[model samples]
Target: MHRAPVVLERAADREAVPDDVWVELRRAARELGFSQIGVADVDLASAEPGLLAWLQQGLHGSMLYMERHGLRRARPAELVPGTVRVITARMDYLPRATSDGWQAIAFERLHRPTEATVSLYARGRDYHKVMRARLQKLADGLAERIGPFGHRVFTDSAPVLEVELASRSGLGWRGKHTLALSREAGSMFFLGEIYVDLALPLTPASEAHCGSCRACIDVCPTQAIVSERRLDARRCISYLTIEHDGPIPEEFRAPIGNRIYGCDDCQLVCPWNKYAQRASLPDFDARDAFDAPSLLQLWAWNEDEFLRRTEGSAIRRIGFERWRRNLAVALGNAWRETGDAALSRALSEAREAASALVREHVDWALAQRDTPALEPGS
Candidate 1:
């Protein structure tokens, strides 16, 4: 069920926030594993036109919720009445165990077609659970400092323009890939917000640092980054494998490669990500099975096994059918590349029990065994 918008009545008797509140909030946020915090005023009228144009261009694909929410996303005050300032928090999500040269390691996984590559972000506990709970704690700490104030916490859960809010408040500049990028933290962090009635001072916005660098746009598997900052989600492998619910589009299947959950190619190629910070909390550590599992290993999972392994994971939200569908596509890419009879046999075995959607992809996977394997980026 969709959650009703959280609207809190502003407290008439609320105490004036202390001038040192921002300093206190940052100290508290850091203790809770947040990398940085900033405040953004609620006026986002200037962003509406570009947002409307993106929606009108159908770049968001089947994410109809983006269309439905409309300008309310830009106007945070309308979504949460009396929301004067949005407290934006950034948390670096590179797993605690991630090592130096991790981007190279991730690129290596992409080259090994038989390996099932889950995006680093989805490898551990669901970020929604981790981020929301911490953001609520941050809000609670503020309430303790300045008495009770109307506030609501959010991660990626709502229609809020998270990147816009983060960028507006100095968390980072929007990178060419359209993700918030900081010189200190790169594009590998999660962003959360606390909408409050308190009138806090706003953080100054950061200036764009990506000059003449087209790495992110140039590296997209399907060229989803249509221009510098514009992404066509329809062609994006991450969207195709996750947000997109139907059959894998034919054109993007080969380029999708072995990425079964989400794609990290754009981030991997970005020059700034060498500075990507490791997650301070253990909540994002890569689970053993997902660390570098093979296509066959993930393919063997029955619905019950899929549920068991993906418990408390964002991957579970995609459900078992989509899970198998993605695996089938990845297995197909592997089958083409390796001409591995094991991949073909695995797809054939699952064909009978699969849903019509999965079976179609399974059949496609089996058919790929005879195709010539093209080199990556060919």
Candidate 2:
């Protein structure tokens, strides 16, 4: 899907700066902590079909906003008035200060099976703050470079189709795992955008490098990667544990493993992750709460403790009820694996949680421990 870079001069003219301004913008974004920056024209018609297809297939699950927005997500100008271009930016987030042995630490938690396993991304402070701040700084620098113009900035915001803009702008190609990826940086990063009124010279799209590699597909613990580049989000552990609100489906409970929060099996196992780079900023440090929590440890958290522990975290958005519900599923899986008296006691302890939702999940979990043979059917 790579396209030739449009030619333009960088003379700082009122009409539009040349393509060399792209180099300057890229340098400025990097200096502001972004890993890469690319500009894409507002026309995203190519992605409209895929957006419609994914929605029609109900792959978005309970994220009703994705369906509610309809084609506005793929059409930048419709979402934001006067947006002729999108300045897509990327920033790495592997935690620059993490010890070299961290990947091994993550894998070790999975071996225990009884301990909670959270997605690597959620262990840190909420990325929304860090990325949005730095992206504003990058935008400020752009304003200084080419003078003030009408623009709006976004990071992980619901109003935009960020991956589509990133891929079309040469930031990276969308991988088979459905993440924006680069051969140099893999998918361990955040993306932000500047919907600008001024028409900047657009960068060409990057080529897809996934080729015949199906690492993400093969690594899904719950077989959520239903096809090469398509995901059955309902079966995804991250979706079930984080985005899903109702009862954990009967068919996906055991396969969810110990992922009490978000899941990272697919991304962790991607061969391209060998090239994964660390974030220059340390905003993504692993919080101690998620390091090696046991089902018993997490199940003990009251609503007050959950609120205090997850404050300023993306995990908080799921709210305490879904949080407990997800943990209940994980605890059930843990109990099925090793019928521990403590887990049974804990499940019994939570049978009267303030929220009936938590109590219901806990009741379901206790029943799972009572019938281990029935648990494996998930």
Candidate 3:
């Protein structure tokens, strides 16, 4: 039934919006392409101790920003002066053409020690840009209604407890893998936040549905998901390849499979991912080299090719050095698995990479050339 027209008009011309305003806000969010809209009151004090403990354990790896912010991250009002409530948003990002049971496709890739694999999330345009712009647009639309109210929008930036807000706002439960998960959306979506001074109605939080599932923990290559919802980033392939600056630890090397940029095993093994949704925007479609480039083909790209191809993509942030370093590791694993002549020659040339970091990784890759040759079967 069509009810009254709920509208927020004129700046500072507003007091507190009625609870039913959430219905209108949610409708607007759906029109703007968000999968879910949730409101959360600014009470995250419980998350503070875990945040500090995660930092103190140095489990954040080299992301110093995680350590830089104090507990203001847990306290929204402190981060943004008048943030009485937070509007949490979720956008589904699975690639559009992913076929039925794509999780099996991803899981099979992890078994091929020769194929270079990247996390599904980074295969397209940088999510940081895609999510932040839409979030700001949503915030702007709200400001237009309520008038010049204090607000801040963030998407994976510093000082925002994104997962905490997501879990609290009825969007989803925190999965055992540490990502926010929903029975409907699984865990394959991007999260964003808009902090506003007004006290909007909050959504009823979702209950934990993980139950006894431990698929995410058992499949971790580096055992990074050491325990449920407790990641040890030091051994995480994503942290080692993208965030860490030094040598790839020797111990974690063989277990890494061929994931060059990020790891997706845990998500692939999760049964709930059958509910994963596809992205509506073309901005997230896979492009250029990310669309299943072979290890040798990708290893041949020079620094200029790397820079130009990865422009505006999240992979570019790792720079050409780490790019080569990661590819070299993958090529090395390929060599160990197949001992292909082409793989060996590529590793030889890579040994002289312009950057010292790249050269070191290349040399390590070449050392795998003499891996024990497969024996004849009985």
Question: Best by TM-score, which number?
Answer: 1
**What are the per-residue Cα lDDT tens digits for candidate 1 across 1-378?**
112246665634455467788789899999999999998988899999999999999999999999999999999888888788899999999998898999999998888999999999999999999999998888888779877778888889888999999999999999999999999989999999998888788889988999999988888889999998899999998999999999989888888899999999999999999999999999999999899899899998888999999999999989899999999999998999888788888888889989999999998888887777766643
Give residue 325's error in model 3 in angstroms. Answer: 0.6
Q: Write the per-residue lDDT of candidate 3 for residues 1-378, one digit (tens) a residue.
A: 111112212224447777666676778788777999898988898888888888899888877877778688998877766567899999998888778978877777765656678788898999888888888777767767656566677888758888889989999999999998999989999999887767687788889999998988987877798788999899888899899878898777666657889887778888888899998777778785886778877788888998889888999998888888888888777777777888878778667545887787778777876764321110
Question: Which parts of model 1 are misplaced by more than 4 Å?
Answer: 1-16
The clash numbers for all candidates, in the given order, read 0, 3, 1
Off by over 4 Å in 2: 1-14, 18-21, 99-104, 370-378
Residue-level lDDT for 49 in candidate 2: 93
TM-score of 2: 0.91
Clashing pairs in 1: none
TM-score against truth, every candidate:
0.97, 0.91, 0.92
lDDT comparing candidate 1 with the true structure = 0.89
lDDT, candidate 2, 1-378, per-residue tens? 111122222223348766777788888788878888888887888888988999999998998988999999988777776677888988888876666656566766776667888887888888888877777777777778777666677887756988888999998888887888888887888899877766688888999988898977876777887887688889888888888888888778777777888777777767777788888877787788986677778878888999999998889999988988888887877777788878878788767644787777777778776565432213
Query: lDDT-based ranking, best first?
Result: 1, 3, 2
Top candidate, metric lDDT: 1
